[model samples]
Target: MHGTIERLDDSALASARDRAWSIPLDEFDPGDPELFRTDSFWPYFDRLRKEAPVHYCRDSVFGPYWSVTRYNDIMDIETNHAVFSSAASLGGITIRDTPPDFRRESFIAMDQPRHSAQRKTVAPMFTPTHLDQLAINIRKRSAECLDNLPKGEVFDWVDKVSIELTTQMLAVLFDFPWEDRRKLTRWSDIATTLPGPDGLVATEDARQAELMECAAYFKRLWDERINEAPKSDLLSMMAHAEATRDMDPRNFLGNLVLLIVGGNDTTRNTLSGSIYALSRHPDQCRKLLENPGLIDSFVPEVIRWQTPLAHMRRTALEDIEFRGRQIRKGDKVVMWYVSGNRDDEVIDHPYDFIIDRARPRTHLSFGFGIHRCVGIRLAELQLKIIWEEILKRFDNIEVAGEPKRVYSSFVKGYETLPVRIAG
Candidate 1:
C-alpha cells in the first residue's frame, strides 16, 4: 500500500513537471497558492531558474510581477534597498497586494530610517543574554510537550508539537494571557491566509474583521503595558520605545501582525518541516540520533531545507537595469528564496537533506539585508532545544502519512502531518 502511494505521488509530480515545461514562459504563475498547496510548484521554479532566472509574468491572480530565481540575484535585490522598496504603500512584501484602505505599515514593510527605529525596539529580546535566559524555559516546555504526546498512535505533529510550542513561545514573548495564547496562532493564520471559502476566512471583509479583533485585543495589552514599568516582553518594549510607542492605529496593528506572524509561523513551520525532512532522509536522522552534538548544524540545515516563508516581494523604487533585464519603476518583484535555496550554483547538492553541511547557514531562509527576520536567533534556539529534547526521548518517530501543506505560497508550512512513535 505504501509503495503504491509513493508511485502515484511520483507519477503526479512527473505529470506536473511535463505541464510546467509545456506552458508558455509568460503563462507561468509560480506564485499561485494552488501550486504550493499541491506541492507541484518545484518544477515550475526549476524551469524558471534554468530558462528565465529573472522572468516576468504579465498576468497572474496577483497581477504582473517579476520573479528573481537565482541565489546571487535574490541577494542582489534583497540588499539593494535604494532601488527596491518594501513599503506597505507599494503593496508591502507579498505578491498579493493589500488594498490601499487595508494597508498596514509594519517595520518589515517600511523602508530605512523608520524601519531601523521600529525594529531596534525588539532587538534586545534576541540578544545572546536574552536567548540564554529563554533557553531554560524552552527546554522545560519542549520536554513537557513531547512527554504528553500519544505514543504508538498516529497524531498530527503540526498541531501537537509545532503549533503548540511556537504559540507558547509567542505568549511568553508578549506576556500574553495564558488561556488566550492560541489567539496568536489564529491571528497569525488570518494575517497570511488568502480569503476564500476554503481558506481561514471566507472573504477579505471577514479576514479584516478578525484582524481588527486582533488589533483590539492587542490594544488592550498595549494600554496595560504603556502604563507599567518597562520590562523584557515585546509589548512593553514597543510600548516603551520612542519609535513605536505613539504609532498610529494602522501601524500598531501592522506591527502586531508582523511580530505575531514572525514569531509564530516561521519557527512553527520549520519545526514541522524538520520532522518531515528527517522522515524522508532517515540516514541524516540516524546521524543526529547517534551523535546528538550535530543539533547545531541540523537546526540550520532543516531551516534551509524548508525555507519556510518561500518568498519576499519588493517593489522597484525606480526604473533600473538588473542583470541585463530592464525593471521599471513601481514593478512588483518577488525574490524566490525557495528557488534560491535550491540553486545548485550557490549550494552544493541543494536537493539533499544533509544534516551536517559545512555551510548550513548559507541559504536565504531568514532573507538578507536590513529587512531580515528580527527573531532569527530565537527561532534557531527553539528548533535546537526542541530537537535536543526530542532526541533524548524517542528512538524512532515514524511518518505515518503524508503532510498536508498550507495553501499560501508565502507561508510554506504543514497543516497536518500524521506521525507515530513507539510506546
Candidate 2:
C-alpha cells in the first residue's frame, strides 16, 4: 500500500516537472501559493535557477516582482542593504503588499540603526545562558507531550505534537496566559494567511479584525508588564526597553505579529517536517538510531531540507542592474531561500536528505545578513532536545498519511500530518 502511494506521488511530481519545462519563462509565477500547497513548486524553482537566476514576472497575484533563485545571487541581494530596502513603508518583507494605511513597522521590516536598536531589545532571550535555562523546560514539556501520545492509533502529529510544543514555548517566551496560549497560534496563522473562503478568514477586513483583537490582547499584557519591574520575558523586555517602549499603535502590533509568527510557525512546521522526512528516509532513521549523536547534525539537515519560511522580500531602493538584469526602484524582489537551499552548486546532492552531512548548516533556511532569524539558536535547541527525547522513548513513529501543507508561499508549513506509533 505504501509503495503504491509512493509511485503515485512520483508520477504526479514527474507531470509537474514536465509542465514546468513546457511553460515559457516569462509566464512562470513561481510565487503562486497553490503550487506550494500542493508541493509541486520545486520544478518551477529548479528551472528558474538554471535558466533565469534573476528573472522577472510580468504579473502575479502579488503583482510583478523579481526572483533571485540561485544561492550566491540571493546572498548578494540579502547583504546589499543600500540598494535593497526592507522598510515597512515600502511593502515590507513578503511578496504580498499591505495597503499603505495597513502597513506596520517591525524590526525585521526596518533597515539601518532603527532595526538594530529594536531587535536588540529582545536579543538577550536567545543567548546561550538563557537557552541553557530554557532547555530544562523544553525537555520536560517535550517528554510529557510525547509520553501522552496514544500508541497503536493514528493521530495528527501536527496538532498533537508540533503545534502543542511550539505554542507552549511561545507562551513561555511571552509569559502569556497558559489557558489562552492557543490564541497566539490563531493570531500567527491569521497574520500570514491569505483571505478567502478557503483561508483562516473570509475577507481582508475580517483578518484585520482578528489582528486588532491580538493587538488589544497584547496591549493589555503590555500594560501589565510596564507597571512591574523589568523582567526577562519578551513582553517585559520590550515594555521596559527604550527602543520599543514608545512605539506607535501600528509599530506595536507589527512587532507583536512578528514575534508571534516567528516564535510559532518556524519551530512548529520544522518539528512536523522532521517526522515526515525521517518516515520517508528510513535508512537515515536507522542510522540515527544507531548513533543518537547524529541528532546534532540531523536537526540542521531537516531545517535546511524544510526551509520553513520559504522566501524574504526586499524593495529595490534605486534602479540597479544585477546579474545582467535591470531592476527598477520600488520593485518587489523576492529571494527564494527555498530554492537556494537546494542549489546544487553550493550543496552536495542538495535534493537528498543526508543526516550527517559535513556542512549541514550551509543552507538559507534562517536567511542571511543582519536580517537573519533572531531565534535561530533557540530553534535548533528545541529540535535537538525533542529528537533526543524521541530517541530515548520510541523506536519509530510512522507517517500514516500525506501531510496537508499550508496554502501560503511565504510560510512553508504543515497544517496536518497523520502518524502512528507502534505499541
Candidate 3:
C-alpha cells in the first residue's frame, strides 16, 4: 500500500508540474491589471496551496520571497509577533525598495512596544461608536456619488463609485479640504505599488520621484491640519498624539499616508470587486436584492470574494520552522490572503460565493493578530452602507463592461468597472 501510494503521489505531482509549466510566468505581468482577469492566478494559487504551502518564488520584480499560502500557517506567523517582527530593517509589508526612513514612518512596519503605542493612539478613532457616526456621513456621500448614475448608460464604477466615495470619506476622516481629496488618493496609490506592466515607473528612480511627490503633498496637508483644534475626525486625533501620545514627523506622515491608502484602496477594490462578482452571478445578485437583509452578512462575503489587499510580506526576525518549511532569519515571507481564503481546512466550499456564508469574518481579508487592519470596521462599514444605499435607490445594478484591476501586487483592485443602473 505504501509503495502504491508513493507511486500515485509521484504521478499526481508530475501531472501538476506539467500543467503549471504549460502557462509561462512571462505570460503573467505582476503590474498589469489584465493578469487578474485571467484564469492563470486562481490555478497557480491553488497549485501553491497543494504543492508548497510555504514556498519560495524568485520570479517577482521585488526579488525572491517565501509564499505562506495556508490559513492556519499565515495566522500563526501573523499573530506570533515575537518570532516574526514588523521591523523596517527586515523589509516592510510590500516587497520593494523603500527609503530608509520610509519604513520607519508607518505602524505597519513597527513591531512590539512601538506598534502597540501607535496603534492604541489610533484605535479609539475607529471604535464601534465612532464608525457608527462615520457611517451616516459615508452613506450620504455614497448616495450623492451614486445619484449621478445615468440609467442604462455604462460608466466606470471604480472611478465613480469605489475610488471617489472612499477618497471623499478619507478627506472627511482627515477633515481635509473636500476639493483636494482626490490628491490624497493619488498619493496613496503612488506611495505603494511597483511600476505597471507597460514599464511605467519600472525603475526605482521613477518610483522614488513619485514617493517624494506623495510626501510633499501630504506634508502640505499636515501643515494645514496640524494647527486646527482637535475634533472628532481622525486628523484631529492624530494631531493630538504629538502631546498626549507618541509620534513624530516621520511616523505621523507614514501613518497618515498609510491611513489614506488603507482606508481608500482596499475598500475601493472590494467595492468594485463586489460589483464584478454580482455581474458574473446574477443569481447571487437577485438573492441579495430579494433578501435585502442578506446585505448585512453579504458584506463580509464581498470582502472574502475580493480579498483586496492580496498578500502582505512579513520578515522573519530569526530562523523559524513553519508549515514543514525552514524559514531562515530575515527571510521575506508573503502571507497570501487570497489563497488562505480558499483554504479547505478553515473555510467550507472555498470556491463558492455564498452570500449568507455564516462566519464570513473568519476569512483572512483583514488579516490576523495585532497587525490586522486597523480600519477593518471602517472598511466594512463603507461597503455595507454603500451597498445599502445602492440597493435602496437602484433596483438593478449590472456590470456593463470588463473590469480592469490595478497593476500592483500589494493592492489587488479594479481600475475600471463599467456598471449600469438596471431598469
- Each candidate's TM vs. the true structure? 0.98, 0.98, 0.88
Which structure is stronger by TM-score: 1 or 3? 1
Q: Compose the digit string of candidate 2's lDDT tens values, residues 1-423.
A: 011123137789899999999989999999999999999999999999999999999999999999999999999999999999999999999999988988999999999989999999999999999999999999999999999999999999999999999999999999999999999999999999999999999999999999999999999999999999999899999999999999999999999999999999999999999988887777888889999999999999999999999999999999999999999999999999999999999999998989999999999999899999999999999999999999999886888888899999999999999988888
Q: Please report the candidate that would top lDDT against the real structure.
A: 2
Across 1-423, the per-residue lDDT of candidate 1 in tens digits comes to 011113127688889999999999989999999899988898999999999999999999999999999999999999999999999999999999999999999999999989999999999999999999999999999999999999889999999999999999999999999999999999999999999988989999999999999999999999998999999999999999999999999999999999999999999999998888887777788888889999999999999999999999999989999888899999999999999999999999998989999999999999999998989899999999999899888878888888898999899998998888988
- Model 3 earns a TM-score of 0.88
Ranked by lDDT, the better of candidates 1 and 2 is 2
Model 3 Cα lDDT, one tens digit per residue, 1-423: 000011124565566456665655433223223334432356566766776677776565666678888899898889888788777656787756466645545777788776777777678878989888888898788888878877777778888888889889888887778888888777777776666546346765676676667667766755565687667777666667743234665666667777878888889889888877776666778888888899888899989988988887788888988877788887888888988999988999888778888798889998888888898888888888988888888766766666556666677777777777754
lDDT for position 333 in model 2: 99
Q: Write down the lDDT that model 3 would get.
A: 0.74
User: What's the C-alpha lDDT at position 359 in model 2?
Assistant: 92
Please tell me which model should have the higher lDDT, number 2 or number 3.
2
Candidate 1 lDDT trough over 10 residues, lowest sum: 1-10
Residue 23, candidate 1: how far off, in angstroms? 1.7
- What lDDT score belongs to each candidate, Candidate 1 first? 0.93, 0.94, 0.74
